[model samples]
Target: MNNNSNLSSNNNKILNTIDTVMGVKEEKEINQQQEYPPLNGQKLLIYVMGTLAQIGFMTLTLWLINLGFKQLLEYNLDVRINTIIVSLFWIFFTIRSRLFSPLDNTRSRRQYDQVIRPKWAPPAFVFPIVWISIGVLRVVSSYLVWQELNQNFLALPLIIFTIHLALGDTWNTIFTVEGRYGLAVPVVIIGPLLSSFVLAYVYGQILPLAGWLIFPSCIWLMVASVLVINIWQLNQKD
Candidate 1:
């Protein structure tokens, strides 16, 4: 009887061990499934639409604020204080508008890689650095323009600058977010590239130093325009 009981106990232990191992395996699979849920076509469509909606709202709000700034400048505010306030607004707007896109994700990066780039295209890493520098130049140059105007935000140069900012954001949406490379070509030309040149000319008229500061961005945008045109031609189907 003692031998039989000892054998039964060993069998039960083996069964329990197998059950535990199977449970752990099942749990791991469940966790993995939860972590990376399947992204179906409908889900992807919803995500894109949602992102577009958010961007649209943001652009509208920014425009309203731009108009509001025009009214605010009409007040008898101190010049230095107004300059600081206006600079802060532009800085916040620039950073937020640029960084609010969904292109930072792995999927977007993959999509960018899948596109056929020009032989002279700069590396993907160069874009952020270039854009950030350009953004800083924009804010500084605008500040200088405002100061040169004697705190006149209603001037033509500042108006052009505001339009330029809007166009830049719009081009980003069309090119990167919407994946409309063909449509993006014209948008890039008439939008940011044209605006850059206009801004350079206007800024130069207002303040020579401001114009020079923004001129490099114009050249950069010119190169970018050519790059986008090539990209559209190469990836016509995409």
Candidate 2:
């Protein structure tokens, strides 16, 4: 009877050991699955689609601008109406392109105003200057196309300029629209750095005059980025 009881006790202990080992293996597998989930093809497809959409949209904008200039040269539009149309068109286009959050929505963010704004934030006058500089650059680009001057070589700087604009506007949307100021701070810096580098490229390989014209805008962007950093710091509680 004693020997039989001893054998049963040993069998029970062995079963317990087997159960514990299986439980640990199952837990490890669960953790592995959590750490490394399956990569869905849908994400890749969405990324590709988004990139293609942005590229198509920007190219269309360039085409429309060129068309508008052609019409202007032909005196097809009344002077006052043309000015109004161009202003409204650009305003709507920039809004639709998500350059900024809705004015009302951005204004609703009381936290942005709770702290004193940086003194160096671009003043009202600076905006017109920046816009004028951008317009000059666009005109220069159009002139280059009209003159049939090394467009193939100039293409890189133009592409870079487009990218810089997109990134800067996207950063604005992220900060003002999404209220992701922390993430936007880095983006603000990055956008200007990209613009500066592209300006250097334009100076070296493209039109030196065009490069000089855009340099002030680059400085403005850097100043804007610094202001953004200050804003982020002030609103950290959010």
Candidate 3:
């Protein structure tokens, strides 16, 4: 009788262990499924159309600006041309950020509010204000660099600056527009953060004042990188 009782107890323990293991496996599967829900066809179509439109507009704008800059170089424009260049930079960045993916839009604000941000994360209103200041810095730094380079559009520093701007816009598209939080982690670091440091260094080599202006942007990007990583981890199951 005692032997039979012990055998039954052991068997029950083994069954319970198996149940626990199976439960854990099933829960993991559910979590994985929740992490990546099935793609919505309509959403994908909209994203594709929007991306194509943005690309076409950007390409045309750059081409026309390039042609205009070349013509301007032929003429001996005075210091006033620097003002025009600054205005152009401001317009280009404004259109690139606002027209394509306005961060202050109702949908964007709603999405940002719904996210599980870190305690250190600033309010949604802070983002647009910060970016506006950064944009001003970018415009000023680029103008200074252009003046230092004798308005050479093809200078290495300017090329890197342009590439950096493109990377920042790419990050905005991925993070804000596409809502790819996990992907945006590496994109922000590898794309904008890295490029900002590089631009700062390169610009510093050319002009100290230009570098100083961009240094704040680099610091801001670092803070943004941390915020992005925290947001991704906090909302992984969302």
* Cα lDDT of model 1 by residue, 1-238, tens digit: 9999999998767644543322212233322211223435774465455456545555565567668877877897897776677888777665555444443211123335658998999876456556667878988998788778865555678767756765676666556645667767887898789989989999999899999999989999999999888989988843
- lDDT minimum window of 10 residues, candidate 2: 99-108
TM-score of each: 0.62, 0.52, 0.66
lDDT of 2: 0.51
Task: State the lDDT of candidate 2 residue by residue for 130-207, as single tens digits.
Answer: 554455554454344323443232244544555555565555445544556676677677664566657555653555
What's the candidate order when arranged by decreasing TM-score?
3, 1, 2
C-alpha displacement of 27 in model 3, angstroms? 35
Worst 10 residues of 3 by lDDT: 24-33
Listing every candidate in turn, what is its Cα RMSD in Å to the true structure after a full C-alpha superposition?
17.2, 24.4, 19.3
The clash count of every prediction, one per candidate, is 0, 0, 0
Model 3 stretches astray by more than 4 angstroms = 1-66, 70-78, 94-107
Error of 1 at 141 (Å): 0.6
Q: Give one digit per residue, the lDDT tens place, for model 3 in 1-238.
A: 9999999998767654543322212233322211334446774464445544544555455556667877876787785875677577554654344344322111144446668999989987566556666877888887788779876555688767756766676677567645678877887999889999999999999999999999999999999999999999999921
Q: Model 3: what TM-score?
A: 0.66
Each model's C-alpha lDDT? 0.68, 0.51, 0.67
The weakest ten consecutive residues by lDDT in model 1 span 24-33
